[model samples]
Target: MEPIGHQTGRLAAFDSLRSNVAGTLYEAGDPGYAELATPWNVAVRTSPAAVLEAATADDVVQAVRFAAANGLAVAVQATGHGIASDLDGALLVHTRQLAGCTVDPGGWARTGAGVTWKTVLAACADHGLAGLCGSSPGVSVAGYTSGGGIGPVARTFGAASDRVRSFDVVTGDGRLRHVTAKSEPDLFWGLRGGKSSLGIITTTEFSLLPLPYIYAGALFFGTDSVADVTAAWSQWCPTLPPEATTSLGLMQLPPMPGVPEPLAGKFTVAVRYVYTGNADDGARWLAPMRAAGAPLIDAVQTMPYSMIGLVHSDPEDAMPASEASCLLTDFSADAAETLVGAVGPETGSPQLLVEVRQFGGALSAEPEIASALCHRDAAFGLYSVGVAAPPELPAVADHAAGVQSAMNAWQFGASLPNFSAGGGAAGFAASYTPDVLARLSGLAAHYDPDSLFRLGQVPAR
Candidate 1:
């Protein structure tokens, strides 16, 4: 909500911003300020001087121009899945009112900044089309695609950024422009993964996949069989074809309303999978994982693409959370042992979830048009998340560090942008190589010479 007793900006400044835009503006203590300023992660706080609930792209341009003239920084939030702690003393652009999605039977779709994956999926289902979507269907398409989104069918369809057709964006210099591979080559490359570094995107269009339906879901087992299941997964992933995408998660679930009866208030391991190919081949390939250990719930089977969100079943409600992640060099036998010893059932771990996903299929290959997104050759991704209250944040942060340190031998020296949300410059350095970062900095200076696009993990030259 509103910061304790600290007021917002000066009345004159608020008046100036209000006069510049047609959308509604709320200062810190205003009626709608609290609702507009609150973010999804309660553990992370945002105290903006003012919030602009932009009604259209024209409002976005006006807000940018106002921030530039006032010498104030700017930050953007849609669904708030990726908001960081950099919103202080800045003007926030709220894009929730920019929602729309239209799918053409010609194999392409266009959406506004506020559209979510769930909306796109529903629209595409009527045409027997599938769009690349992340685990959580509620996150905005702009936020996910800006961070180089990885989805349930990532191995088969590749990253969401690779399929983007064009972007309508407003750079920090207060200019709205269209970005495409052939038109604005540098901005097109930088925006796909650089995210909030060069501009604020207003709309994005991308290609869609043909044919619906997929064989996907998760097999749940008690934590007692974690070691056995992990070992089997390590051996089985190498044998899988590009049509299959899979991950293994060690879960410590709290007894909540939506959690299943078998997994509530218990420790468990889930082997989640998705296959885009025919059902017969998918079942044949997934048989060994099902036989690895007797599952409490054998929920893996063929399902329509419209029901894809059932595969991961990510949390939809907002909660206080702290997360840490790294790319893995390998998932060897010793690596499995390291994972168990660090955050396993007997380790007295504090994290709610620890997961590792297999990579390297179409994900490793370059798209015909390349962007700044990197780490394509990374073998696997290791991520851990802890529930955090305001007072217990230090312990959660330290425990995540310890988990990352425990598997230092297997680290790939890079991280994924979507997962490394709050990590600032250090995480930015880890995600991109020296060359890409250098190019991003060069482009940032050329496009945003005033350095107004200063949010998120932008590389500093």
Candidate 2:
């Protein structure tokens, strides 16, 4: 079978594609094709030969089969948050129409690929249940979990993929499989950390926590106090138990609405923390940081679990952005000094946000069902983001490189999938070990012999 040519807008197999699926199909020049094909990262221009707005798992199966038959590669997108590169004339499967979400009071959730953490958070709030959600609840549950989601409460609960019960996916071979630890175990393990490398996830089911509330929020200190506050935080993290999750970010927030006046248009350090324990104990654990320095805004307090979104308060609006990331073996005081000197106020960095998130506790331990998720013992996650624009974007990458160079001594040499979105083959390669990548590539060969899933973050190719 010859590989599909670079044909855009129309195809010889359009009739069969339309007949086999209930979802709408669009060519490049079609009225809705632009909107349907656009990704969350405006930086990536996806120009697929065809787009399928999948309405069902069966629709996904049909789309894969169609791509296989036509000798075309296939790509999957839910919220487009993980768009790595432009899809050049491939078949794009958009799972926006698979909006199914159901929660059991017994502390479990099942969601279609279209469902986001916001939807799951809202639904589960009614039952005092909480799903492991990343900073931005707007991200798709399936997409996030598939990439081994590292959420705000990750120190306590571990990665979202660790909590997964099962996944209903359409593999590259055109089969709709119901996968679990006991059934199709290899597929189950591969799908968890492989992202969309193995298949298009149609629906996902995962376990949830039953806490009604948490003692969580952010403590903001002015840049003038960055030195003092950072020192306190660096010293405090080592003493934290598994129930206490925390991170510190240096923010360069614009003076927009919802942005506090103190932090807007100014350099500030935000110490974000979440405690799963009781209020008194949580406060006792957090007391030193509260007294670290005179905070401009101290919002840390006991709040309902439903308000968990406020802890990180990540940007919800979709816009173009560039990011770089790496894990750390340890964050020593010397590393802290190196980081502050690298991207702090003195550096005049163009990047919008720089973060050093603590990792330990439950994150270091593997779950009962082991998976392909790697870098479990990483001590911290260091990431940076900048506005992606015509002239300034290049500087972001350069500046990020300089920062990583400054902290090279503590580098863990790997990163989580959620943070490696725009990273190329090297970035993707750093995400897993040679053994895991080899296993994933082997599985991709067996499950996707034609390399139909080449467009995802997977380095299967």
* Top lDDT prediction, candidate number: 2
**Candidate 1: clashing pairs of residues:** none
List clashing residue pairs in candidate 2. Answer: none
Tens-digit lDDT string for candidate 2 (6-86): 343345577568988999999888999998888887766779888899889999999998888887889888888888778
For residues 181-237, what per-residue lDDT tens digits would candidate 1 score against the true structure?
A: 999998999999887777889999999999588999999998789999988888899
Taking all chains together, each candidate's TM-score versus the true structure is 0.97, 0.97
Off by over 4 Å in 1: 1-9
Evaluate residue 354 in candidate 1 and report its C-alpha lDDT on the 0 to 100 scale. Answer: 94
C-alpha lDDT of residue 102 in model 1: 83
Query: Global lDDT of each model?
Result: 0.86, 0.87
